[model samples]
Target: MGEDDDGGREVYGKMRAAAALRQIPRPPPTTFQEDLMEHLPAAIYTLLSCWTRFYQIGKNNHVVWDEAHFGKFGSYYLRREFYFDVHPPLGKMLVGLVGLLSGYNGHFEFKSGDEYKEDVPYVAMRVMLATFGVLMVPLAWYTAKELGFSNRAAHLTTIMVLCDVAWLCISRFILLDSMLLFFTVLTVFCLTRFHTERHDPFSPDWWVWLTFTGISIGCVASVKWVGLFVTALVGVYTLEDLWEKFGDLRMRKRDYINHWLARGLMLIGMPLFIYMMSFKLHFIILNHSGPGDAQMSSLFQANLEGNDFSKNPLEVAYGSKITLKNMGFGGGLLHSHVQTYPVGSQQQQVTCYHYKDDNNNWRVEKPWTLPKVDDAGEIEFLKHGDIVRLQHTPTNRNLHSHNVVAPVSKLNNEVSCYGNATAGDAGDHWQVEIVDDLVFGKREKVPRVRSLTTKLRFRHVLSSCYLVAPNSVLPPWGFKQIEVSCDKQNNPSDPHSHWNVESHWNGRLPVGETKFYKSPFLRDFWHLNVAMMTSNNALVPDADKEDILASSPTDWPWMHLGLRMCGWGDNQTKYYLIGNPAVWWSSTLSLGICVIVIAVYLARMQRGYRDWGVGEWDHFLYVCKIAGLGWFFQYVPFLIMGRVTYIHHYLPTLYFAVLMVGHLFDHFVFKSRRLKDTTKWVIFGIATGIVIGVFWWFRGVAFGIDGPIKEHWGLLWRKSWNIYESH
Candidate 1:
């Protein structure tokens, strides 16, 4: 009976997909309307191809690695689980489908330091993302069309995104960054439909508008948290919708608000609900592990607040709360019962029965966990602060990091035994705590210790939550200490700030490893594109330190790049020149294009109209050309000449360029419907003089010693650029 149902479902799914495929026109893989990929300038294509390859096999799934710590498909799969598994499931599903189609569902273990040789899944994932990449042409084209750009401008926009190395690199990767670009651009396109739609709620386009808007937003959030930024952009559109859709007809504000509310409920609300549901059901599937402990803690507190999980043990035990908080970082508290710390009490520390130590310097020792948990099993909680200990293996073994080979190589006491060829005693480098078995019984809140004395008790686990310690796999950034003790009796302020931590290693635990980036979505590559007097820009000294001293566990978005292949360290070798580098010089170049749009708009805007040439076509074009010079300067250097992504030096070049673009646009729009050529030239001269002459005069501040234009700057560019240099 079950087999029959399964077969029926499979047939139905294929039928649905086939129908979807049939509904759309399948043009041969040919270029239409001057695409970025197909119709791009050859130089642009070459750059994009190189970047796409970088993104495809650069940082995420296709990373270069030391022979001891590399895993390809397994690493990819583990990253999905360790990180949030929202939209990547589709990509994973595609991978699984490709695997099944190729009839290699089982593992074909490779020799040491070998790469996976499968081409089908690679081709499938890359082609799928590539197809989306190609789709970007139409999407950007339609966006320009929505904005009412001329055939020339709209077509150019398509070329820009297509030729863009950022877009190309993302396309080559097997993750959600490119997908996110697709969804966001798609949302903007759908929003254009709303913008162009008339005021009438009864119009046929209303339903279609709502459908596209809602689904696009839904899918946007499904890709990653950054979707919220687009969602906000949508709300901005909603406000503008009143001005665009209703403005032409002179509809009252009330009518505009009411009509949009109705459409918004259908479009915005429904899709958001669906996107959230994806997470909820997934949490239900992954019922055990440390999250259960958190859920129980929340449930226990909820019981105190009136709602108890005891009523339906199934509901209580079955699922975690669907919150972004879960995806963020939160590792429970730490206590020492066996005298792990000074002035410690065993009873106060023994909130949970088991405590395992993954720290090298030995903060806490084990019996660190409870009994094991099965896939669907869950550990129960008696009350808040019930104090459970860890006792489980992680579903995300990829993040388990490397199996420890030499415990002697292990700094301090931390160890993950890399067993011999036999797989026996395979090292204990990492310890995963399961919430299910060790024990969850009620306990009294005590007064001896502040932890137990508190009204709120927590499910403390022995595993190192990112909140407690960073992964030891990557290079260490800034430093921190857990136990900073101050004289409480003499201090009246926060202790951590004033605590005199002995600089020696005597009492401090070994510095835990900072987690290596497991996905392309999160990378610690902040390109310091500082703007200098609009003439030059420079990268910051700590460009490689993406989030070294980040405030929280999640701030280290090392895993945020998700699964991109855009390289590990953000390159910054391009901003040494005085003028603008090329667009590919840095990811920050996207801001440069934005500057161009606003410049064109300001130079000829008619109050709130979309027409770029509303007041004066030639003048607007002139301003646009100047603005284009900035981009030309920006891109030409990077493109024709080989350079890299550096923002600080590039910023000075960009700053004045941006202001000129902006002021030129604003001046033309606000100054008048028609102005004299003399007046235009005067304004242009003033803008140019203040930007250029002033920069040249105070060149030191604007373009430091080794800035783009600096003739022979000192050691400014050579500081803090390498990962191996000790601070």
Candidate 2:
């Protein structure tokens, strides 16, 4: 009986213990709390770093560098200016939207270095850009953490970015670089997150990360085409990830196809949709005409409201007042002004002007006789191969070309408006051969303005040369417009010699059907893309005269130069865009160290020293390789680019390079088994402290503090910094 009672007590005691355990609250796992704690320092540092000098962004009430370009574009959007840029429209659209919301009138000219008057509301734009700039630090910090850097290393990486003077200067201005960098870094961070969670494949959380990464990629590319580099990086990583999955023995073929389909929909389809939507929004918002109309086609211009091209397309006839447009790409309207090429033929200069003006108008006439009007108001229609004379309206001179050489094209015959006499000489006579096409087994002469395919060649009767608008700019004497000359080769197929009547007026004929109705979006999209590409390709800065602020990719990695954003009165109110020297140099050195460490690791592995634990080291090495590849793709491509690049172009590369530095320091220095924790902390502390100190010292340049030149010079350690002083 005693034994049984003891057994019952034991069982009851065990039950009571179990109930007590269940009653006690099981607090949420510390893993999430641990993660928050781990990232706490970096989060705090990023916030303080971004917010510290944020308000000071608007101190300088003036336009700087490309601020003039982008600011004007923003205003143009609000006023519905049909402008063109080499980049995609999302960044400028955002600026425009912000300006509109803030009650900005969009009236400021935003000329280079122009001071904003008291009433001009420029603060909102600057603050908005600065806000994006400040966010870069946190984005970069998150990226580093996701890439497997330790907490201290992640915090230090944020510090390096926050302390960059170039980053600060660019952020504080109304520029696209900040927005571009923000989206680009966000893309990389999201991609890292996606990669980390990719083991789950088609899980809901995994899909969300993948989708976010795709959207971020679209946003980055929408800012600048340079975002393609990030796109390539993500693309390669994804392909490699999928390839590894396919090779996995346990993975079924069906799962592989599903993975591929999922990635295709998210990465390819989603990004394309978002990118097209950006352009759609751009086309919708900018409904009115602006300065950029001249760069587009007649059909495109006809679509804009309040544009001269939007007028009725008139019929062609003798004595018609018309504007002759070049049919070639980037061709302009035939124009003549009172000014002549000072050195060339001393007659009135005949050139091609991209915009419409009184000088562009000309009266069509027979070779020597005036067209007779019938009693019923009927007039002679200008036919193919008809010899005619073009009389300049403003100058009352005939379109003439002789053996004289052109100012720009020395080999070509000079074209000018000549002859004070109404009955001009043979030099004024030209055969107008209309471009023809076979229609229903018969060659039909194409009419002017009615058919865009119509091409005309003005063959000089005496000189035996064809009127040609070369893709070259004339001298200042010719108003710096496109050069129009007479080429000896009168190839009817040459587009440069092809002419079409763009603006026509004939009293005898009624106005034709209007071609300005809304067309299909795809057709407009195709045409606009072609026009934008043509315009962008034409924007080649002269290589012989390099701008003082221009930089090359080779110069970027060495921190060899700085750009002058703006200045007033010999360095007064100067804004110099230079990276923080300590940060740049340290990051640059870290890259070299990373290379050496990687080599040594490879050597050790080749010699069969594999005891370092394969899984952890392999993961670390893989992340480093990816970060290195990102840096390479961003920086190396600029080496071959022919465009005029600036120091700000290096900002994207700097983001990845700084991440590599953080990764290197975390793995090799901070986590080194040979080094004591105290020593590691000391090293990191000194490095970060120096970077912060330098950033604070040069904070004047970033914030546009105006004072004595010597005061600013005292803070610079590199002699290249003197470039700003001389400027």
Candidate 3:
């Protein structure tokens, strides 16, 4: 009786399984129409983006705003000449590549407001750069889809990106902003792709997306230092992800170790390799010496073609023609010009210049009143405590100082070139005080000054002042060079007071060995990166002078002001960089809405209200974290940055805010069960209409305005915008 009962139960279970299997329906085959419909939104956005970015791109043939700068950098690349700039090389390399493909020979100087010559190919280059902007709309749409947004939310994201006027204006010109924006969006997109493959970790697809994410990180950072903000976002996300895995009790020790190894190799190691490779390529391409040679170390400049540092004498001696260089970080060559100071002693101006020229050459000679050294006499090596006069080789003026105040540094005495070769006074004397020696060690009784190694200071014999070149820049009359003054107080620790013989020439001494001047690639790389950061940080606003175009970071999100991209002359074509009000205001509002919504949800959860399923709650938190944190990382740093910022600096941050808008719409209206599908579609339509209408209304500000500015009165939606010419 027991065997019969068991048989009956097994038969009943088999019958139930067969019935369930028969009830399951097969998926329908994908058709061409269905696939086209699926991709139609991105395709449409791409088309619109191309239209907005490329339409009348060449209407203004004159170099506009930063095009004067970035276009010249591209020319430098094509000419294979080294030039120094605060930005990294990848974006400029791309610009050069565009010029090469368009048949530009790097002949055009691209002076601001200068009309492009017939052979410059400015239009084609602009068109190529605008392609990056053209791809941005589709990238945003696809990124939204990867983040699990509904179709309605994805479409809204695409429209918002497409309709932003400032993004459009920046892309249509020759600048790095477009490339920076594209790479930033690409990084986020790749990150979302990597996240979706977490369930199948260590698989081929997972590794591919992860590697792509790393490459994108490298590419973005190589364009600008601002790219680090997005990199930081990626870093935070990775840390959170690894922390979650660490908390998983089911994970094996070997698997966890493997995860750490993989991330270290692919994320940190790969991006660093890519960044270093860009600098390596930059050094290779720019082998010729150009205007920026003085900005680099003497050793690094020695390796460049056309540089004469390799031919320099090994040691400094009396009667040697030399250029003195400040040993401070990012310092320049001690220079003097024929122009006299408008204020102070009214003598020939002494300054620090970052370019190699005849003005930088000075001859080390005995005090003007002393007997001239014989040519055939035994060489008198310049040593510690030597009294000498640095005669301006071009003008034959002795380096002199007086009690008159300096033009910039008022506390310091004025340093100028006074007496000529024949005329002389006691003020012409300078005592050479050796600080230390890099090669020969500390000061010796007969210590010879080694070129490029021995640090020295010139003290005014009569005034007891140390000649110094501080970081203070002179006024426009002095060509905006670093100010040179005579310090009344002695300070051995100040690098600004330190000087070294950078370039020496004497018939008596032999050329230095190449081994002595070899600068390692890693050291040069580190030095250049630090110098760039230092220079970038020095770009703060001046309280004494007003810059009409400058705006505070607080003024960005609210659209308080807009920038005039070029001249406002009635005869010239112009562009105004302002955002579409509907998009910027709504996106900013979404940030506040996000904070309130998260708080309310947490309160409800505390009260035991289950508003969402487990998977839904997790998804909501994930998307919100990426959007909020991405915005935070990109924007909050600007508040503390000492550098002067423009509205365009906020462009990358705006992308994250726009993402928040899409996520909120998906969670509250589109995908929510509380909202009907008809209501969701209606709301999406109204939002899209507002965005498109505002963009159309302000489209001329980007596409280019012809004729008089007074004709385009409605372009200034905000009262503070400088779009209109002053009456």
List lDDT for all candidates, in order: 0.33, 0.76, 0.87
Candidate 3 residue lDDT tens string, 15-92: 645533433132255699977886898888899898889898999989999999999999999999999999988999
What are the models' TM-scores? 0.43, 0.82, 0.85
Alpha-carbon shift of residue 426 in model 2 (angstroms)? 7.3
Cα error of candidate 2 at position 394, Å:
5.4
Candidate 2 residues lying further than 4 Å off, grouped into runs, are: 1-32, 324-353, 357-362, 367-378, 384-500, 506-516, 538-546, 570-572, 723-726
Query: Whose TM-score is greatest here?
Result: 3
**RMSD of candidate 2 to true structure, Å:** 10.7
What's model 1's overall lDDT? Answer: 0.33
lDDT by residue (593-685, candidate 1, tens digit) is: 556665766765646655533324433443344334433443334333221233221221232233233433344432445876567556545
Query: Candidates sorted by lDDT, descending order?
Result: 3, 2, 1
lDDT of 2 by residue, 1-727 (tens): 7655775566756754553343313224469878788668657766775675474767777787898999898898888878877678899998898778767788889998888877667887777777788788778777877777776788788898888888888888788988998998899989988876755678887999999998998899888888879888888888987876655545689999998998899888888888788888887887787877655555556677776544444556777888887766667789999886787779898988877689999988677655432425657777777788899988889999889998888889999998853556778889887665222121263544242334567888888899998667764456557889999986877877988676777656676644533445665565456555544555545645667778777777778888777774644577778888887787778778888888898899899887464245656766776778888888888887756688888998888888888888888788688999899999899979998998888887787767666654565566665443655
Residue pairs that clash (backbone atoms under 3 angstroms), model 2: none
Summed backbone clashes in each candidate are 75, 0, 0
Question: Which has the greatest lDDT?
Answer: 3
